[model samples]
Target: MIKRLCFWLRADRLGPDIPITHLMLYFPALMRMICSKRFNGFGEGSEFRPGAYADNCSSITIGKNVAVRPGTMLFAEKGDGVPGRIIIEDDVLLGPGIHFYCPNHSYKDASRPIPEQGYFYKGDIVVRRGAWIGAKSVILSGVEIGEHAVVGAGSIVTKSVEPFTVVAGNPARLIKRLR
Candidate 1:
């Protein structure tokens, strides 16, 4: 049993017999390298297991022990001369398929065409220390999730999350306080 566990943890030895998901589950080192090189441009420590994506902003500061799962997309806008930055502080866990946007459209201008509406607004994303963003959540631009907070799965976080609170659902509402 121990030998089998060891083999799974080593990505180099992992082969076609094991599915990609299984490999990521066991080999954290492989994920770390991928994130550091492929995603986020530059990442630090064992916190992130990365992927392919664009990160041009220096605002994307990540803290130690921050684990961002597979299929997570982080982006800054082209409209904002400077790419919007994201700061994920220490011990934060971002689940799979989590999408974060640092920009938004100006839909308030009803007279403008949809395509033209693209030229609207952009914002920064800040995930404070010890926060947990559940699977498949969409964190909009300019939203700050406070320390030790929990965001529920499939939640669309549009506003700032309070510290030590649990929020869920679209446009995320407060579910309860974390004890």
Candidate 2:
């Protein structure tokens, strides 16, 4: 069991895997130790709970005092050799089942299979300071969620949200302004 645990503890191997999930739950400090170097920025006072999945963490920068709940997935796609950045600023609140996807698969060619075509990455996903993202929200590529903004549950954010605003629904229309 020690050997198996050691294998999963490697920097590149940590993710939504069950063993890692248990480790993060039972020994969060251990998870922090491994992730501190792997992530571009894993801030102080931040918590990545059990069942939170991330790929290309080297491209992810998380700020101070952020709370990422269970079932959240952070996929930071790399273009060329440089990874596409996913920046989550300080004091942010992410609810369960939130998914941040930075890569969009290309399907321009109708003749060829989509998988064979290739993939393209959008720009960085920036979640500014003090924002609250509700459960099951999907923040797509090239989107900027402004400071102190609130995203309602199950919202699919396609465009950049303005500061202090509340957005919801499939296309994530502006519901109200908080500021």
Residues 1-179 of candidate 1: C-alpha lDDT, one tens digit per residue:
77766554443212233343344556877655534543343346644433423344244666777665666776655354556677787788888888888877667778877667664444678898889999999998879999999999999999999999999998899999977
Please report, in order, the local distance difference test score of every candidate based on alpha carbons: 0.69, 0.84
TM-score (C-alpha) between model 2 and the true structure: 0.89
> TM-score of model 1 relative to the true fold?
0.71
C-alpha lDDT of residue 168 in model 2: 100
Instruction: Give the runs in model 2 whose Cα sits over 4 Å from its true position.
Output: 1-7, 11-13, 79-82
* Candidate 2 C-alpha lDDT tens digits along 82-123: 467799999999989999988777899999998787777768
**What value of lDDT does candidate 2 attain over all alpha carbons?**
0.84
Q: Candidate 1 overall Cα lDDT vs. reference?
A: 0.69
In angstroms, give how far residue 19 of model 1 lies from its true place: 19
